[model samples]
Target: MAEFSNSNTVIVAAGENLPLTETAVKAPACIVHREGSGLVTLRGLTSGQCRARFKVSFGGNIAIPTGGTVGPISVALAVGGEPLTSATAIVTPAAVENYFNVFVAAFIEVPRGCCVTVAVKNTSTQAVSIANSNLIVERVA
Candidate 1:
């Protein structure tokens, strides 16, 4: 299992995407973690013999525009820059609340040498001030 986190001080503006910039746990070379990109690559897995489970999360206060309706802010796992829509979480901020947390988890199997990348995308309309974040990847089979 491997883990990564951020400085808890990164602010994500609307229409901007940023990667969490810290590697807290060092795993096997097959894990292939990239610095600053926040992308963890899992390779060398034989089909039907290996399964990887990963989760990504971020928590903070959201700033919603005044008089504007709530919008869906989504977080998902991206494999090679393509997001897996089936495993995603969306959170909408209302005027009654300011703090929010978004996360998504997926268990998947890949063929040998297939590069799988992981990151978080704030697919929403509100600006987020991320206070803390984490990503954990583990091999299940």
Candidate 2:
């Protein structure tokens, strides 16, 4: 695995303000998963310190961490988009006004013709939004 910094520069919706209840960080269509056996990692950040909630869905079996980091870490799992399991992570403190990273790491085991997806929820009562993030997929045999 390559080492990476948990820095994020998100371009949130223009008209929206901070302290959002929950927002979706829509991924590019090209980044979707395909049938295979490997690991998929999603990394992102919030504008401020908040609790991040994540969900991962796979047609087969996948193992993921239940807890994440404020700057960058992996998300947990969910059936579709709703969290099948819950996890929490903190972001940069509100005073700093810095973007915090969120990540979802999974070791996927697929039978055949299966797929996976990752989604996130800003669990902070103060409302949070994502601007931009990156997805890294590593194949392991």
Best by TM-score: 1
How does each model score on TM-score?
0.72, 0.36
lDDT of 1: 0.60
lDDT, each prediction: 0.60, 0.31
Q: Please, what are the lDDT tens digits per residue for candidate 2 over residues 17-58? A: 211121133333222432221233333222342322223332
Kindly list the per-residue Cα lDDT of model 1 for residues 87-127, writing each as its tens digit. Answer: 55666766623557665677756556565666665555655
Per-prediction backbone clash count = 0, 11
Error of 2 at 76 (Å): 5.9
Model 2: CA > 4 A from native: 1-79, 84-88, 102-104
